[model samples]
Target: METNHINQSPIDLESLISGLKTEDARNLKLMLNIQSMMWGIAAVYVFISALKFIMTTSWYDKLGGFLTLVAFVAFALLFRSYYKEYKTIDYGIPTIEMLKKAAIRYELFQWRGLYVLAPLLLEGIGLNLMMFDDFTNLEPLNRILFFQISYFFVMVIAFLVGYIIWKKRQKPLRDYALALLKEFQS
Candidate 1:
């Protein structure tokens, strides 16, 4: 009589880590795309708004508003995609989980800061334009002042959020990478 035995293979930690790295790279690319799209939209909006101000007409106002709305929608979609990706990770894979958590924290900071601060800054600019009677009355000095103030506010908020996320995730990311390296060596 002959007996049959079943064979089991060990978990391929290197392959697992490689896969995690690939996923992280993909997520980073997506994040960069989202950021680029946001900046592009913002630049276009600023240009349109400036043209409207210089022309001293409400004709472009509707188009500007529509573009702003589209940008907001695009941001919302990106946020949702980020949230979904963050939630779908397998925590059993400790290193991958840590990386995913770091990504989630970064994305959360970006979403909150950009969504809240950008609109507030834009509203301030719109209000300033409304208060000025005409483009000629909005002197170069006044326009520069408004632009600088709003830019400062947005930059400060973005920097603060970015710093917080970096500080919070640095240790975890390092530990995760080290752990993965150890696993690979063993």
Candidate 2:
């Protein structure tokens, strides 16, 4: 890139450092808030499911609520684990080396974050497996139709979320990191 007669001078080191720190702090707060909200939502679902399990007359709703309650609690645990970890990341220093190290560590954290989603994936599969009885009680045609329709919706939503994260989040983050860290790479 040409350096001469740019519209504006490059950002000062202090400004860059402060900007990065602010960004990290803001990101952490947002993450923690989201996790807390997820936990809250899961807890609410668990309560609702418990009420349904106790008060409902249908075998289907009872079993379904109990199973869903388990899944929501599992999700709450996942969020709690990551929330604790997010709470621990501190602003260390404003130096370039420290920032570079922080960036690398953040990348590792992102990978480790996959563990946070494992419970959801496992529960999703488990729910399907355990749902045989849920289907068996219903009429054959309705069972097959409903199951297929639910799975179709789930798969479409999964695909859309995956595509969105890859395109809007992952790619942009990778590009931003490469550009931002280029100066410190020696």
Q: Which numbered prediction scores highest in lDDT against the true structure?
A: 2
TM-score of every prediction relative to native = 0.43, 0.49
Work out candidate 1's RMSD over C-alphas: 11.3
- Clashing residue pairs in candidate 2, if any? none
The positional error of residue 62 in candidate 1, measured at the CA in angstroms, is 1.4
RMSD of 2: 8.9
Per-residue lDDT of model 1, residues 1-186, tens digit only: 122221232666667889999998997788778668877777777776666657756643544454555546455565666667655656667765565455555443455556655554554454544543445567757865866687678878978987787768765665666566567557
User: Compared to the true structure, candidate 2 yields what TM-score?
Assistant: 0.49
The lDDT per prediction is 0.61, 0.65
lDDT of 2 at 18: 91
lDDT tens digits, residues 13-41, model 2?
66787999999899789877887887788
**Shift in Å, residue 127, candidate 1:** 9.6
